[model samples]
Target: MHIRPEQAGDSHPIAELTRRAFARAKHSDGTEQDIIDRLRKRGKLTCSLVACLGTEIIGHIAFSPVCIIGAHNQHPQWYGLGPVSVIPAQQRRGIGKTLITQGLATLEKTGTAGGCVVLGDPGYYQQFGFMPSPNLTYPHAPAQYFMVRSFDSNIPAGIVRYDAAFDT
Candidate 1:
């Protein structure tokens, strides 16, 4: 298996993989794929990565700029992680984890080390240093499901807002 940055032709497969991965997820709103599409259309998809087995893309992860309401309303020092998808057949094989690790590392290198937030099971995400942060929030989602990974130990206290596409 190879993990790498997404290229020109990966979009369609990424969308398919996303749809198939989240189609029946208990917490999915059935719009996971659409979120990514909207993120791209609005030019907010900052980092998108894929895990490929041979010539086929099997998993995908997307990261986009997040706005910190109140105090730190400036250039994005943070990002949001979501719709991390691996085909049903590929689930439980570490593909999602691999995509996430690679994606976060790439984002950190880009000077976005402020942090990244994810709405996911703490059990799965905690291994990556993600923890429930009452300091940050996404109002529409359950607070307990919101996890954060602060790179510089500077996790800000603010209302976390994802791109407007999330509302679409």
Candidate 2:
């Protein structure tokens, strides 16, 4: 298997894989695939990576800019990570993990990102240095399930607003 940035041809495959991956997820809204499409259309998909075996795309991950709503009204440079998907057949085989690790690395290397946030199982995300902080929150989910990994010393205090596509 190989991991790489998503190519033009990977879109539909990624969507199908994502749909299959999240079909039974406990917290999925059943629109994960549509969210990706909307994000792409809005030009908000900052990083999209795919894990492939041979010519088939088996997993996918996406990172997009998030706004930290605070006193200043606009908190730039922070991103949201989510909707990571690995096909049912490939789940637990480390494909999602690799996509996430590589995606975060790509974001950090940009030198513009202050941090990344994720909403998911604490046990899984913590291994990647993501932790819940009283300083940051997401109004739509339980605070503990929302985690943040800051590249720098500062983890801003505010409500994290994901892209509008997430509203789909």
| Reference-based lDDT, each prediction | 0.86, 0.90
Which 10-residue span in candidate 1 carries the lowest summed lDDT? 67-76
lDDT of 1 by residue, 60-110 (tens): 999988888874544448899987999999899888889899888998887
Q: What's the lDDT for candidate 2?
A: 0.90
Q: What lDDT is obtained when candidate 1 is compared to the true structure?
A: 0.86
Error of 1 at 33 (Å): 1.1
Which residues of candidate 1, in runs, are more than 4 Å off?
A: 72-76
Residues 15-74 of candidate 2 have per-residue lDDT tens digits of: 999899999899887899999999999999999998889999999999999988883644
TM-score per prediction, in order, is 0.94, 0.96
> Considering every candidate listed, which one attains the maximal TM-score?
2
